[model samples]
Target chain A: MPLPAPSPNPNPAPPDAGMSRRSFLRTSAVLTTGLAALAASLKPLLEMNDFPTMERFLQKYYKEMTPEDMEKVLKRIEAEVEKQYGIRPHVRDLKPMDGVEFVYCLNLTRCIGCRKCVHACVAENNQSRNPEIQYIRVLRLPHGSLDIEKAEHNYAPESVPEKGYFYMPVQCQQCKNPPCVKVCPIHATWQETDGITVIDYDWCIGCRYCEAACPYWARRFNFTKPSIPKERLNPDMAYLGNRPRRQGVMEKCHFCIQRTRVGRYPACLEVCPTGARKFGNILDPNSEVSYILKNKRVFIQLKEELGTSPRFFYYFDV
Target chain B: MLRLVLCTQPRSSLVAFGGSARMRPVEGDALTRAGDPMNSQTRTTLVLTGLILAFLALTTLFISNLPGRPLRQPPIPLVNTNFLDTATVRRSYADLVRAGEDLSDFDCYACHEKGKPPPLRYDTNQNLIVPKEHSDIVMGHGSHGRNNNCFNCHNETNLELLQTRDGHEVKFADSPSLCGSCHGPTYRDWEAGAHGRISGFWDRSLGAAERKACVNCHNPHSPHFPSRPPAPGPHPLRPVATASVEPGPNH
Candidate 1:
C-alpha cells in the first residue's frame, strides 16, 4: 500500500545459504504438531458443558456438606432446573423420622398380573419415559414356580390371568446390605436411616459400577439428557428421590422417599388394583407389613445367598 | 519427502542453535520448547497452562449448566376392563366390605309382601334361580351345577338376612363369617391378614386397615372365578426368551 512492503519470501532457504529445504519445512512441522498436541490434551479442561461445572467440580461429598451448604446447593439446583425445564422444583433434603424402618410386602396370590404398580412408579418417580426407565419389572411366573428367571416380563397379552401364571413385581429391594452402595466409586449413593437407599444425582459420574453390583438390576443410567415436559414434571421432590435428574446419572426406586418419609403411602401401593402391595414401618408391631411378616409365609428374592437382607418381602397366602 | 521432513526438524534446531548460540532471541525460542513440563517458568507455557486451566474450569461450568430437556410423560394406557371381569376387583376393602351396609335397614318385604312366590327350582340347570316374575334376575352362580335351591344358604323365614351353615342368622355385611364356615383355612389366613387384600394405613395407630371379604373378590352365583384380561404387562426392553416353557431351574 505505502511502499509495498517487501514480499516476504515463501521459501527463504537457498542451497548457497548452507540450509536445506528439508530443514526449513521440518522446523515448521514440529512447531505446528507440538501446539496441536498440547491443545488436544487440554480439551477436558477447555470443553464447554451444561452443569455448573466449576461448582460441581469443587462440591464436597454429600455426607460432608453442612446443612447451610445443602440449602444453598438446593437453591442452585432449583434455579438450574427452572432455567432448563421452565418448572421450579421444590427440592428438599428430607431426613428420616425417628423409630421408622420402612418395610414392603406383596401378596403374590392376590396380584392379578396387572402392571398398574409399574406405571404408577414411573409417573411418580420422574423416571425417563423415553428409553423407558422403569423401576419395577413385574415377573409373570408359571404356577408353582418360584424361579424369577423362568418368569416373563414381556407377557402383556390381550388379557391377563392367562390360566397358570402368578405375578411378582420386582423392584429395588432397599437391601440392608446393598451391594450398589458399596460399589459406588464417588459415594454418590448410600442408605438412609429409614432403610431406603438414595443417590445424589449431581455427584454421580455415571460409571455404572452400582448398576452392575445390583443383583436386582434395580438401577438405571441416563444415557442422554432426560427430557421431561414442563407440564408433567412432578414439582414435589426429595433430593435423593424423584427430583428431575440430568444427563449422566444413575437412578432407581427410593421407595418414594419424598412421600414415605412424610408418612404418605407410596404411589405403587396406592395404585395397586388388587391391594397386593403393603408398606409400613417395621418397628411398629401393629403395622400391616409386620402382620404379613409375622403371620404369612414370607420369603425374600435371594434369602440365603447374596446376604443383601432386603426389606422387601414376597409371600403367598396360607 | 515425508522422511526428509521428519529427519530434518531436530537437525535444523541443532544447527540453528549452534550457528546462533550468542543470539539472545534464538536462544529464547529454543528454551521455550524445552521448558514445558520441566521448569514451569516460560511465559508462553505459563500463559498457555493458565489458559488451559481456565478453559477447563469454563468447560466444566458450561456442561454442568447446560439445559436438560424435560421428558414428555408417555401417555398412560387405559386398561381394558371388560376382559378383566371377575378375576380382578379394583375397589378397596372398605368399599367392598360396605357392599350392603344398610342390610339391617333394608326391608325386602316392601317389594315382596305376603304374596305367592315363584317356584324356587329350575327344571334342569340348578343355577337358574330366576323366577318368571323376575326375569331380569338371572343367576349364574350354579356354574358347578350344585347348590341350586334357594334355601340352601338363605334363611326361609328372613328375606333380608343370610344364614350360616350352623343355622345362625348373619348380616349381609358379615358375609365372611358365612364363607369361613366352608373355607376354614382361608378364613384363618384372611383373619391373619393374608388371603385377601388389605388397604389404608399399615400402622393401626394411624388408621384402621380395611380387609376384603371372600364375596368381595368372588361372584357368589358363579363361584368359579372367571379368567379376565390382566393389566398391561411390562414394556419389553429386549426380546424376552424367558417366556418359553422353561428358562432356568425351578427355584
Candidate 2:
C-alpha cells in the first residue's frame, strides 16, 4: 500500500536545484560586504613606511642570520639608505671581538654639562634633524641631592657646571641584568658578549615594553618618520649601530657599536670637552676604565639597587 | 515593561509599585479605548517624529556651537649651530707640533727675540703687566694671583723652551711634564688616561688612542674653563618646549 503511488509531493523543487536566485543574490551581497569590510580593515597597513621591501620584511633575526645572510642584508640596507639619504652608506656588520668587555666611566668632578656629547651623538648617529632624537640627556642635579626625580634634563644655562648643581649625563647603562632586555617580548634587544646592549631594529615590533621597563629612560621611540639631512647623514653605519632607523623602531646608546667594535672611541666620548666620559675594555687590566673602577673612591652606579649591575660607572675625584 | 504599561495606562489604574506588578498586554487599554487606534497611533507617530526632529536639530546646533579643532603644526627644523666645535674641544698640542703647522700662536720667538727673555714687568698691584706683545693672554692660572709671574712658566735662559719649577726645559708639546711639577696629582691622572680626554682606540694593539694634552682643553695662561653657551636642549615629540631658558652669551 505504501508503494502503491506517490502522494502528491508537498513542495516541488525549483528549476535551479543548487541555488535559487534569491539565495544566490543574498550570499553574493553578504560576501561582497564581507570582502569590502576586510579591505577597509586592512587599509592602514598601506600607510606603513617601515616594510618597504620583501627582503626587509622577511629578514631573519639578528642571531639567526649567518655571515652570508648578513652580507646580503647589509647590502640591502646600504641600498635602502643610499636611496633615501642620497649617499652610499658603508653598512658593515661588525661582530664583537674576543676577550673585550666594554665599560664606561664618568668623572663627576670634571663634567661641565656643555651637552657637546648630546649633539655629537645626534650628528654621528644620523638622528632625525626635525624631531631631534638624542641618546644622551644631561641632567642638572643639585649638589646636596642625588635625587634623579628632581634632576632637570632641560636646563639651558648660559654656562654649565652651574653654581649649585652637578651635571650627570645619563644614557643607556648597558646593564649586565638589563630590564629592557627582559621586557622585550620579541627579543629585539639583547646584550652582546662584549657587554654592549644592541637592538635589531627590523625585528622590533615597536611594542615599547622595553622603553617602559628601562629605569634610566634610555630607549627612545621614533614616533614620526625619521628624517636626516642628506649632507649631514653619517655614512659609516653598522648592522646593530647607527644605521638610519625607520618610523616605528626603538634605539638607544649602543656604545657606538660601529666604532667600538672596530677599536675606535665612541663619538660622545671623543666630543666631551671636559674628558669626563671614558670608555675602554674593562677586561684589560691596563685599560682606563679599569683604572677608574679600581682607584676612584666615590664610585656609584645610577640605580644600583635595582640589581641592573650597570656597566656605566660614575665616580668623584676626591 | 512596567514603565511602558504605566506610561500607557492612566495613573489611577495601578494597584502596586512597578517591582510588584506583573506586566500586562498593551493592546486594549483605557488610552486605546478613549480614542480610535488610528487616532492614537497618529498622535504617537506625531510625538515620536517631533522628538526625533528635535533631537537632530539640537545635535546640529550643538555641533555647530562647538569650537573648531586646532590644527597641528609640523615641527620646525633645527637650525645649524656651531656647538660641536671639535677643533677647539679636541685640540692636541702633540698633533700640531707633529704636523709642523703654524706655531705663531704659541711660538715665543715669533714675538720675543731669540735667546733673550722679555723683562718681567709688574704693575702697581704687583700683577704681571702681561706686555703688549702678549696682551691677548689672560693670566688667571692660580686662584689667588700668586702664580702669575711670567718667569713661573717661561724659561728665562732660552725663549723657545718652557721650564718646570725644577729647571727642566720642555718642548711646547711636552708642556704636560712641566705642568706636572705644579699639578702633581692631575699630571699623574692624565698619564693614566683618567684626567684628560682620549679620542682613539680603547684597545692599543688595534689602533692609537690619542690623548689630548692638558693644554689642549685648558689655556696655559688661564687654566680655568671659560663659560660658554651649551648645545640646544632636546625638542621632544610632544611639541612642548622643555627648555624654558633661552640661548645666552657664549663667553
Candidate 3:
C-alpha cells in the first residue's frame, strides 16, 4: 500500500491535523490571557520598590540573613532614613556585650512627679511628636495604694508629689518571659541576650498581637505616620531601637538601646530630676541597679499572676 | 534542517561522513562517535575555559562597580542644651570645686579673726554682726518656731566650715556629711541611689560621675524639697479629661 506523506504533527495530534490552525490560535489566546492576568497581579509586587515594600516582602528573618545581606540592608535603611529626614542616620547593629543584663529600678519615694523623664524619653527615643508617642507614663498614685488601675497617667497637678500622692513612671519592663515577644505572629520581636525585647520594625507586619499581649500597657502603636521635626530627631539610633519607626509598627522602650548598649544611662535616668530613675547591668556586681535592688524595698508591676518576670523594678527607700 | 552543518565540513569522501565538505543522505549509523574531530576531553576543556572566562569577567565587573571605601564622617556638632530645666541637671560639686567656690565665697576671717590671738568665741545669738553684707542671707531657715542662729550650722571657730551636731568641722565640699548628721535617713537614702539627683554617667567607670550635694538642690536655709512646675504632660490627639484634682498650670 502506498503510504500518504507523514502528517506534519510532531506527536499524537494527528487526529486534529485538519483544524491545527484554529486549535493553535485558541491555545495562544488562552496562554496570552493567563500571562496577562499573572502580569497584572505581579505589577503590585514589582511597583512597591519605591516604599521598600519589595525589600520587606523578600526579607528573611533577621537571624537568617548573612553578614553581607545584613550590611546591604543596613546601608539601604541608612540611605532611606537620611533621605526621608534631612539628617545623617547611623543605623548600628550592636550586640549586647557579655555578662551584661540590663535592669531599671525606680524609687517611688524619690520620684517627684516631674515628667522630665517622659519628655526626655520621647526626645531621646525619636518618638512621634505630633500624635505624641511617649514610652514613659508617670502615674500619680494616691498614697498607700499600689493599684495601677487607679493610678492616673494624665494627671496634671499644680505641683508634683501632691501632698498625698506618689509618682510612678511606667515603661517597658523588658520581661525575661516577654508576652509581647511570645504573641508576635512573625518573629519580628525577640528578647536580646541582655534581656531587652527588641522589635524589628521593618519585619513587623503591624498585626499588633504584641501590643495586645502586653500586660503593662507598655507598647505603643504607631497609628498614623510619625511626625518628628528633623532638628529634634536623634540621628544616633540603633537598628532595633529608637531608629525613627514607621506607621503601623509597635514600639516600646528598649531601655535606650543606643545609649545603654554603649554604657550610658537611659535618657529617663539621665534627666531624672530626683535621681529616682536608675539603670545598669544587673550582672555587674557593683552596678547601681544592684545597689538599689539590694538596699531598697523592690517590687514588680502587674504580672504577679501573669509571671512575665519583668526586669524593671519599683523600689521604695525609707 | 536542524541536522545541517555550516561553514565547511571535514575532508575525506564527497559525502563528508568520512570527512569532506559535501552533503549526502546517509543512514542513522553513518555518523559514528569517532568520526567527530574533537574528543570528549577537548569539549570539556573548551566548556571549562569558557566558564572560567565568564566567571572572571563577572567578578571583575562586580568588583569595579562596588561602592567606594567609606569615608569617616566628621561628627556633626550638636548644641548641648539639656533635656529639662536646671532642676534636672545642676552644676555638680566637682564643677563648683573646680572654680574654687567650695567655701561659699564667704570671707570669714575679716570679722571673726580681728585680734592677734582671735578668741573665735562668736555667740550664736549675735545676729546683728554684719547686717549690710549678710542681708541677702535668708534667715527663713529657722522660721519653724525655733530661734536658731547662724552659728547653729556654721562653725563659729572657722566660719568657712559647716558645723555638725557632734561639734565636728565639715568642709563645705563635705556638706552631705554635715547634713547627714541631722537628716540621717534621707542621707542614707541618697547614699543608696534613692533620694538625691545623680546626673551624668551611670557607669562611674565611664567618666566623672556627677552626684548633686544636699545643698545643691535644697536651699540650706529652707531645707525643704521645693516643688516646681512639671514639664507639659502628655498631649494625646484626644486630650484626656484629667480627674478633678486641684487643677494647676503644669497641665
Best candidate, lDDT-wise? 2
TM-score of chain B of 1: 0.52
lDDT of 2 by residue, B1-251 (tens): 33233333322122212233333223335547768867765654454445445555554544444444334657656645476555555355677777888767776666678767678878888888887767888989998788877778878878667898778888777889899999988888888898888887888888997878888888888888766778877765465655333222222
- Note each model's CA RMSD in angstroms: 12.1, 9.0, 19.0
Model 2 complex DockQ against the native: 0.25
**Candidate 2 Cα errors over 4 Å, as ranges:** A1-43, A49-52, B1-71, B79-81, B90-95, B105-117, B237-251
Q: Cα miss at A271, model 3 (Å)? A: 0.6
lDDT of 2 by residue, A28-141 (tens): 544554565565556557767566688887889999999999999999999988888789999999889999999999998888888988988888888877767888999887
For candidate 2, state the interface root-mean-square deviation in angstroms to 1 decimal.
Answer: 9.8
Best by DockQ: 2
Candidate 1 chain A least-lDDT 10 residues:
A9-18
The lDDT for every candidate, in the order shown, is 0.70, 0.78, 0.70
DockQ for all models, in order? Answer: 0.16, 0.25, 0.16
Candidate 3: stretches off by over 4 Å: A1-50, A53-57, B1-94, B99-105, B109-147, B205-208, B245-251
> Hey, what RMSD does candidate 2 come out at?
9.0
